[model samples]
Target: MDQPQNNPKAYWRENLRYLILLLTLWFLVSFGAGILFKEELNAIKIGGFGLGFWFAQQGAIYVFVVLIFVYVRLMNKLDRKYGYDEEA
Candidate 1:
């Protein structure tokens, strides 16, 4: 039988990077683009959707959903690499 191998440090680092990136994006869209820069973004509008309005209403949600999926994907890959993914 082959023994499973795992690198805790690598796993933690990858997870941390993924989380940080996701949080940064969340902060940027939720706070930066939605509130802080609302006035500046107001100067630009796409069709009937204003920049801040679009970001607050749809873009942020979309990005959040995508980020979750991306995290799941990366975690799955990491698990596989570390022999921790049962589904893999």
Candidate 2:
């Protein structure tokens, strides 16, 4: 539900901003670090596995899972801000 006093455009704009920022970060970690900068990242090792290899294999998945939680938190905050949140 939307409030008459709330500016829908502004709320949507902010939502889009968060989406873009988070998606861009995901892209950088998944594609940029896993592929584009793989050689450089490979120099660093975690658990004896190259960082690049880790990112390509597991890091991206972890980041995505974290991002899901972050998105949920962000949306909850946004909903409250806009008075669109439901009583839970």
Candidate 3:
């Protein structure tokens, strides 16, 4: 019987795709909102603080935490799809 082969390259490609996407979102939230769009965001107020200020101080951290969870969830799914899950 021929054993099935696992393609590490494909798995790594998918992993990289998820990493790039999540990192891009983190960068956008941290740098784009905090700096590039700060002037525009400052026009809006969030809890008596400028939107930019909030993003620079608190929002970025919140987004990073959420991203961490998202990455875990996505990687879990990926692992299952690739038959690499420990449960298997």
Candidate 4:
């Protein structure tokens, strides 16, 4: 006999911590390190661009892409752990 699928809501509930962590990182890089602390970070530059500006522009985008991949990987792990994944 097959086990019933875990509730979708339970999966989301269990995964909420991951969402919060990713959001915190997103906030730190985009707001804290980019806008709020721009002046302090101006001492650093990359290819003639201010560190804050880089973060606000290219850096944040790169982080976002990485975050997407991370989320995918983590969700795969989480799904397996919760027995909601098709792979297992």
Candidate 5:
């Protein structure tokens, strides 16, 4: 509460950075592997399914779930860094 306005701005900037990075990663994994590199990835199979097809079907969703957890963890750390209190 004692921090200046610029301090919160810095915190918001950092938050956006995290979001951009994570979202980009998700997009690349989902769109790249599933669509762009499908044929190449098909060479590698997983549980009788082509890697690319797996990604197109279920892998992206799994990745999204993991990313959700990662985001939550990152946000928790970021909140602590910015001295944010959930109860407040």
Candidate 6:
């Protein structure tokens, strides 16, 4: 049996850290590229459409899906590191 390295508070802090990081990335991709930096990204073209337009319409969704998988994988690793992983 594995024992956790830190107390509940520490565990939660780490969890929140991961959440914040992942959510920040999602927000940056969805909003930053889609809206804030749209003009700059618009200078680039992808498949006959502006890069920012693509990001707003489709790229953000793809990034979000990828982020979901990334978050899950990262959390699984964190859980294992902290001895919170489920028994297989």
Candidate 5: where is the Cα deviation over 4 Å?
1-6
Scored against the true structure, residue 80 in model 1 reaches a CA lDDT of 85
Off by over 4 Å in 2: 1-5
User: Per-residue lDDT for 48 in model 2?
Assistant: 94
**Tens digits of lDDT, candidate 4, 1-88:** 2543576887888689899999899889988877998888778988998898888877888898899899999999878767878867
Residue-by-residue lDDT tens digits, candidate 6, 1-88? 4666646787788889988998899899999999999999999999999999999999999998998899899879877777778953
True-structure Cα RMSD, model 2: 3.1
* Candidate 2 Cα deviation (angstroms), residue 4: 9.5
User: Residue by residue across 13-83, what tens digits does model 5's lDDT show?
Assistant: 98899999999999998999999999999999999989999999998899999999999999887777777
Descending-TM-score candidate ranking: 3, 2, 5, 6, 4, 1
TM-score of 4: 0.83
Candidate 1 per-residue lDDT, tens place, 10-70, comes to 7788789989988898889988888888888877897777898877778788888988898
Give the number of the best model, judged by TM-score: 3
Higher-lDDT candidate of 1 and 6: 6
TM-score of each: 0.81, 0.89, 0.92, 0.83, 0.88, 0.87
TM match of model 5 to true structure: 0.88
Candidate 5 lowest-lDDT run of ten: 1-10
Ten contiguous residues minimizing lDDT sum, candidate 4 = 1-10
Candidate 2's TM-score reads 0.89
Point out the worst 10-residue segment of candidate 3 by lDDT. 1-10
Candidate 2 per-residue lDDT over residues 1-88, each given as its tens digit: 5543357887898899999999999999999999999989999999998999999999999999999999999999888787678962
lDDT of each: 0.83, 0.90, 0.90, 0.84, 0.88, 0.88
What's the lDDT for residue 23 in model 3?
A: 97
Which residue pairs come into collision in candidate 4? none
| Candidate number with the higher TM-score (4 or 6) | 6
